[model samples]
Target: MKGLLFDLLFYAILIFACIYVLPNYVIQRTIVDGSSMADTLMDGENLYVEKLSYRFDRLDRYDIIVFYPYGRDNTEYYVKRIIGMPGETIQIIGSDIYINGEVLEEHYGKEPIADPGRAAKPITLGDDEYFVMGDNRNISKDSRDKYVGNVSRENIGGKVIFRVTPLNRFGPID
Candidate 1:
């Protein structure tokens, strides 16, 4: 009878651990489904999103982040990179990103591609808004797309620190 009681207690503890502790402490698994992050993140790659770092530090340029957009429903989330920050003017001209009237030299993309002319007009981000773009400029529907404009700080979920799937392709995201 005592053995059975101990076994029940152990099972209860295990169940509690899975239900509460795991979700709070462990990484959440997600899969990249679109070509938006191409050349940097491939389609169908499994990823472990890190939720701990952003809570302690400020996000930086080139950081790959995940954010919930303003519309199109609550179930979907968008992933992109931080390009233009608050109080900066962002413009896309001839496939290059210009911040505050200066050309940004670093390129994560393999080749130069024309802007879709979707958001050809220059946009100045609000103090709490961030401008994001996909590395795969040609294929990605990102900040350049009218539908997904500057992302507000409130909608940002977290920054992605690494990729954990596809076995051989797993590593830190640039």
Candidate 2:
């Protein structure tokens, strides 16, 4: 009876971690805070963020990521898509995004950017910097804004893998 009780207790702890702790730490969930990523990730939708990937893999262009606006300890967070990679020149002219003088071909931007803001002029990213922007350019406060600026590698928390809520759209994110 003693041996059986010990085994049951161990299994229970393992099950608890697999169901709760692992998902909370290794792969956390975040709710879309705003319409910044409209059409791509809707506001209030639940999405899974893979924390392990950021530690082992490198970030690529167009990958949706979540980060703290001020720092990792801050409560306010923002989700945006990578636009300009490390050491690349980024600029926006007449609602079009140009990377190193070449116009980027992407269908993610929901509408033509009306206000270029700080990115209206050419800005070069550092080796450790990445420029990000929201799909809904019109109202997004992203890298284009002076305060948001370019995101460093450490500031990025994780990649948003997929939407888990709103049953109809449950699947991997594009």
lDDT of 1 by residue, 1-174 (tens): 999999999999999988876555555667888988887888888776776667676778788888777643586888888988889988878877789989887778656767645556688989888888888877767777778888887777777767888889888776
Off by over 4 Å in 1: 1-26, 71-73, 116-118
How many clashes show up in model 2?
0
| lDDT score for residue 89 of model 1 | 89
Give the number of colliding residue pairs in candidate 1: 0
Give lDDT per model, in order: 0.78, 0.91
Model 2: per-residue lDDT, tens digit, 13-89?
99999999877568988999889999999999999998786768788899999987688878788999999999999
Model 2: how far residue 144 lies from native, Å: 0.5
Scored against the true structure, residue 85 in model 2 reaches a CA lDDT of 96
Stretches of candidate 2 exceeding 4 Å from the true structure: 5-9, 12-16, 19-24
Candidate with top TM-score is 2
Give the Å error, residue 67, model 2: 0.9
Query: Which structure among the candidates has the greatest lDDT?
Result: 2
